[model samples]
Target: MVVDRASSTRIVPRDPVTAFGIGNVATTGPTTVRAEQQVSTDLVDHRGRIDLPALAVLFDHLGGLPYFASDPDGSPCVQARLAISMQGGVDVGDRLTANAELLMHDEAFGTTRVDIVTSTGRICSSGTARNVAVGRTFDHNPTGDRGAAAPPGNSDLPGLPLPPAIEPGLDGRVIIEQIAAGTRAAGNLTELLNGRVDTVDHPLGTGVRFTVGTEPWMGNVFGTMHGGIIAAAVAQGCSFAGQANAAAGRDYQVADLAICFLRSPAVQGADVVVEVTPVKIGRRVASFDAAMHAHDGTLLSRCSADVHYR
Candidate 1:
């Protein structure tokens, strides 16, 4: 399916996660996709900047477009691995656009690269998404109407509800203990996911256990938790773990994150648990591993992250 970049032809979102997270989307070419969103306060981090995990959600959406474009049968695909690197900062109210290009693909796997930039032409983030075919064909069209484009602004999109309201006074800083105790809110992306830090006993020191209730809005077209949301959850777990291990008076940032999806958890309003463990804590850098599990302890995904201290 060839999409003319100059025409009004756009890819309509079939899932709530994509509609709510990335806003409007379009297939600019046979191998390229574009998405746009005006950053809102609910998308910012404690630093009042666009959250990395939120960007991961966006990456996950745009990254999957090329595979759909290239497949003639519309084979079912799932995210295999995702890696994102932080480049610059983005604040609330900033209009951001993401462009994704297909790198390579085979019968079993496909890889796509995405770059996010602000209206001011500032690069905000970039990443690559790897997806694997599931050996099945879609029963129905999963991409929705490719010829009809939604009206300008996300509010005009039919059934696209407003994002959850962030509690006032939530500055992007997450206090591990406070959030775990339910005394403070993670706000922003975590708030949107209804993520809560939970207390759990583990052999790994300086770790965190996060739980999020899966809602329909968090699901993919298949009615399961979206891969990008899973990635965001893993990122949050790693961020909390790194913060807990950092020395006093030191500041840290998530340098990069990579996650692999092993299983899909149905979004039945059940709680999904994410456990993070410190792999190594160096003077200038720290590494951590995270695992996402169903409430019954079924491992769903795994992630590794690196944090740079300054």
Candidate 2:
């Protein structure tokens, strides 16, 4: 089943909590907002723990809302970039609460800080974002009702690539494809998001390859994982690899994660391979790179993460 993401990029001033699966659970202060999401079975890994990639994107949507409220109908607030760090894992049906604070919002950039905690008040994840005001506003309606106006198609914009367009219309509505004129097709990075795990012996040390399936959930409108999730997949695998190498070693929180999406993966019928290579294992900070690939040896995407090991 395809997820409807028609208005995900509008950057309008409204309640995004309803758009994403998370709910606006509380408001402690003028600048503070809290959201909670009930993790379902589809959102979890094989171990039934919340998938890091899925959780990371959730942080982006949930954390950005309070800051977006600061701008509302003013500047077009867009999440230019974000980074997430995981401290622990959450399971299915677990309620994840995110408390966000608007750090700053100006004509140029917007930033926010978010902390995600479990029911017992365990800090599981933290995030910082750098968003920008694009100087353009879409149909900003607080009621989320455009009121009978034909929404702008992704292709109508000058150079903005539309979200992966699920083609041919599922039910009499045709969604335009988002690839550029000369853009390349790798596989749906999001489709490869439903992750799988298999252990492999390595000459350097022990290696674990993480794989993922496509579709249903964990995909953008284009039907693939988001760039954030691509990076998180690497971090997730390396976190596993790091833990394996660290056995009785120090636990680390991801301090830095970087990714380059070489090609868009297919939306269906493909598996992504996540192979982690430890660049440096130090007493202070350890680093690793996870490559997302196809079974045919195609390099779909890649990411590198730095962790505070101690």
lDDT of 1 by residue, 1-310 (tens): 1113566353433454343445557778888888776565555443344557667777787788788778887788877998988776676566678899989999889999989998898887888999788864444454564212432343433221233343444322335566666665465556666687754445554777878888665676666777877887888777767666666556667778989999979887889999887778788888888899999999999888888776
Which regions of candidate 1 fall more than 4 Å away from where they truly are? 1-20, 46-48, 137-140, 145-174, 199-205
* Tens digit of per-residue lDDT, candidate 2, span 1-310: 1132575442321221322235545556766766676554434322223445546655765454566567645444545556667777665456677888888877677778889898789988887776665554344432133112222222332222223332222211011011111132212222234455444455554455767654334343334444445555665666555544543424445566655566546645567788877677676776777788876888876677766655
Candidate 2 TM-score over all chains jointly: 0.55
CA-RMSD of model 2: 13.9
* Whole-model lDDT per candidate: 0.70, 0.53
Q: What TM-score fits each model?
A: 0.81, 0.55
The stretch of ten residues in a row with the least summed lDDT in candidate 2 is 172-181
Q: List runs of model 2 lying over 4 Å from the truth.
A: 1-21, 25-30, 40-44, 47-54, 74-78, 88-93, 134-192, 196-228, 243-275, 282-286, 291-303, 306-310
- For model 2 the local lDDT of residue 129 reads 70
